[model samples]
Target: MSRLKLAICVLDDIQPLRRVGSMANDALVLLFMIAIVLVVMAVTLIGGFYLVKYLVERTFNS
Candidate 1:
């Protein structure tokens, strides 16, 4: 019974380290997803801007 209690105590002490590691992984994945979304948005905006500019120039020049 004493050895079982000691083992439980040791496991409890390690739990927080496991939780911290899990949180770090979650945060890393979140940052990667955000970066991908931002890149896609930037490309879309730039493409739209150039398309509009081209259309305006073509209409006015003709």
Candidate 2:
């Protein structure tokens, strides 16, 4: 009976750990999503900056 109780206690402790392991995966996924968004925003801003620069140069110099 005591061994059975001990087994149950061990299983209870492991249960949360197993759940945490599964949930921890979301952290990595969230980081990747944020990184992709940032890269896209950076590329968009860079392209816009060049477009503005070209327009200004063409309008003023030509």
Q: lDDT winner among the candidates? A: 1
Clashing pairs in 2: none
lDDT of 2 by residue, 4-62 (tens): 99999999999999998888888889999999999999999999999999999999998
Write model 1 residue lDDT over 1-62, tens digit each, in one string.
99999999999999999999999999999999999999999999999999999999999999
Best-fitting candidate, scored by TM-score: 1
Model 2: ten consecutive residues of lowest lDDT? 19-28
Q: What is the TM-score of candidate 1?
A: 0.79
Clashing pairs in 1: none
Q: Candidates' lDDT values, in order?
A: 1.00, 0.96
Per-residue error at 52 for model 1, in Å? 0.9
Candidate 1 regions with alpha-carbon error over 4 angstroms: none
**lDDT of predicted model 1:** 1.00
How much is the lDDT of residue 49 in candidate 2? 100
